[model samples]
Target: MSFKYMPVLRSRENEKRAFKNFFDNKIFSSNTIIPLIEIIQYSPNRKNTTDSKLPEEIFEESYVNEFKNYDFPIIVDIPMYIDLNSNIKQKYKDFLSEMLSNSNKKTPSKRLIYFNKLSKLKNIIPVVSYNPNAPYPLKTISTQEKYLRTNFNKIAFRVFVNINTITHILNEVEQSITSEDILILDLQDDDYKETKFNTLFQKIEDIKTSKKCKTIILNTPITEDIIKKNKNVQNDCPINAIDNSIVFSYKSFGFDAFGDYAGIKKYLGPDNNGNNYNPPVTYNIFYAYHQNKYIKFKSQTINASKPVVAPSITKSKCWNMYGHTHHKNCPGCIEINNKSIDTSKPGNWGTWQAINIQHYIYTMNDFL
Candidate 1:
């Protein structure tokens, strides 16, 4: 919830470990080369609200120095990260290529990028990681369905649904109604009321009856109040119950199955006999949510990177991508709870650029 400064262990070693963990795990990637755009708000001039005297320059300098080694085509989320008054936009605003072009020194295209969904900026690609549970844009889901059927047969699909994202799920089902792939809908969280739950179940029942194979995964993230009533539905399968109040567990997997760090592991929960659950690490956060705070603070004084699609995870094989939080030039990270990180204070966030590439490249070479 709050932020703090922490330490960075041997920087290279820690980053290497993070990269290894990210790629080793099983994360879904659609077949398109959609880049993951992670963004964070970077404010260097504003000294620590806690300590105004601390020169912000030193902190930012250190931040950039730490990550400068990661040289790659970084798509900076420009709008949110840079000074609006700055002329980087005007000086190089002649064309789209100029916006991204880095060759001309006088008007070097700063990697800091920015755009709104409807903004008419060409060559500024939009990217998303797939979210199977939520309703999705028809076009996106249609594209995903085509890719899935082409590559693999009998794919084990999972979806983590909630009220907000349910629309996307409906869109996906509508798109997939004629497709050959089976869909396993994992309806997560406990906040929904009975009427809504039944309504959702009915919708699924209809889809299943008409569509290909389908299964329902139900979990109550706080109290298992709803699970008790709905466990017996013909299509519903109770997997696990969790306390949504626990920030770590909620972030780990509760948000969306496979969307968070410990998705499959937490969703499985304990065996029939209640006991300590120790799930294996199928994937780890190469960069944790709060880790981005440090990444941003440690980044250079240069303009912030504009947010773009996550290039690492979204590839030719990926259909759609999803994650929490967004900004024009977001440094894809956040702080939840008061845990102290080791790099800056426990409070700083680490924004990323090219780190996703570390895992993405590895995934393409090793897995695909």
Candidate 2:
């Protein structure tokens, strides 16, 4: 696959619609991508310890029937979506045993039964989500997780280590998860943008050297410096996948899944059946409305009531928008100035976002 972009499905409703879309072939015509989801407890007080807060509704008959519609591997994340809000008398494994067992039957000793049932599904590669809580170090949790994974057949299970935990408890993490498991990292922090690329590259290099997992950067906005062309290290790392949740983000912005826009609707393929362009449409020259480009996101940022302008939409500010744009900023200050984006293009916000996703995929391919 060409740098998989696994979109995260965070809720029951969100997941339901996404799965329906997948079954109907409304999105992801390409096999290179799949919907990713994290199992989480919706309620702060999860009274039902026996029931899983994750994989919330997928096991129901309706969802099982729906899965027969498509034949693509889903990158299922099994990381700890949030800390356990309530205390339990038994370990998580005990809870797992009860979850997969029949309503009247008890199988507290055979936890692998859960994995066996899940593994039967030919389309999902479940990287069981994990989080170690307050009292234990990551090493302990990692060891327990590995034990759980071993109960199932090798092909059925993988591990997803949360970035926050991995960064701190690497040794214990190393003990628990392997290079084969997926490590989830996100550069959503703006503070990270200020650091040298070499620093980040070195960190990635070290992680790759140690964990050696199929790595992923998730739910991050496309930034110029992160994907700037001509940077060799960007493509040299072991990072295997990425997900741009701009569509979901747009929905959060109160739009109805960006379906409101006609220009973008055409690209949201239904029957195209994975025709993500032959040879993978490398975004070189002629990418963004012909010629290289720069994009500066306008902001409504301020400190208190004193409005501060986003450096992006300014006269002198500059950013590396996938390519260098040493363009002098001025009024009508873009177009020619931005070596990547042409202001002359006719598109609304939705159209621009769709084009931007293309830009992201092509640019990230350089890293893969």
Candidate 3:
């Protein structure tokens, strides 16, 4: 298939209250944007693979329900399966069957169970993964496809194309047992940022053209400099066709730029050189979209009862350091390290502006 959906990666729990505000408003609006929400589960170790859980367990039913409340589709990602040992292979099969099996009655077959799950949960999608590094038999992927397509009239499988094993893209197409709804090119670019933009883009194009499935590249979109000049102004800032590329990063999932990585921990200080070595925090901000929903939080610092508290100054604006800026030694960042970055209230000046900077580069004339 050519492609039909825009992808949105899922965000962490604490930051979700912010995005829910947007979904609630859409209940009445006519315009629509349905982004793919991904929930990727991580593996703890190289061996002992039987421990893998369903995507529901890792993402959690409570959090998944929050996303479910919205009208968008959910892509549940479990660990890559082909390379798993026999124990894990059988365990995963059973787990999939049980989760998708009919709730009120018994399923006639394994295929029927998955079909029922897909039917019952109209918005939920399953993802099968391939790891080229360990290099598992392609037959595993082909077999799973057959099982799924047995009963469902139309089904889409989201495959995580790990960047480490880029070679599998070509084979992924030829070996596919049935047509796919969408293929996710999961890029692990945390350490590989400088890989030429065109190089990756070309491979993606080739894969999409060769396969019957709609392909989506998942490398982290380069964060645009929002604190600087307007990216929309042409001439001065040339348009990066790459920014509009048919690519979505983890941030697209509409999760928090903060809290995703930090979890319960707060930001600590920097190293001797003043560089940010703060390991307890991670921020994910999406590019090319304007305006978003943020959670209303109250700080416990001001009073065991009072509200209002807060970040730093940049370019004459009280930028929310926790949402956008991660630079240590700054006023807001210092507060976080000193346990003083206690921000209260949603749409609070700092976070509301800092969360996701969705500025489009095209001029109004382009749309006209």
Per lDDT, the best of the predicted structures is 2
- Best-performing candidate as measured by TM-score: 3
Clashing residue pairs in all predictions, respectively, total 83, 18, 11
In order of TM-score, best first, we have: 3, 2, 1
lDDT of 3 by residue, 1-368 (tens): 22233334333322343235435534112222234433222211113346567643433444444544656554444333223333223433344444434322322333333333444455655555444445455454555555555544334444444445445544654466234455555543232234544455455455545554455544333322331233343321222322332222323332111111111111111223433232211222222122121111223334543332222122112234224433242222333333334334312333422233111111100111
Write down the worst ten-residue block by lDDT for model 2. Answer: 257-266
**Worst 10-residue lDDT window, candidate 3:** 359-368
Per-residue accuracy of model 2 over 200-252 as CA lDDT, tens digit each:
43454466467555544443333333445433432112111122333334323
Q: Point out the higher-scoring one by lDDT: 1 or 2.
A: 2
148, model 2: CA deviation in Å? 4.1
Prediction 2 TM-score vs. true:
0.42
Clashes of 2: 18
| Candidate order, lDDT descending | 2, 3, 1
CA RMSD per model (angstroms): 20.0, 15.8, 12.9
> Which stretches in model 3 have alpha-carbon errors above 4 Å?
1-12, 27-68, 79-119, 131-133, 151-165, 175-180, 190-207, 210-212, 221-368
Better of 2 and 3 by TM-score: 3
TM-score of each: 0.26, 0.42, 0.45
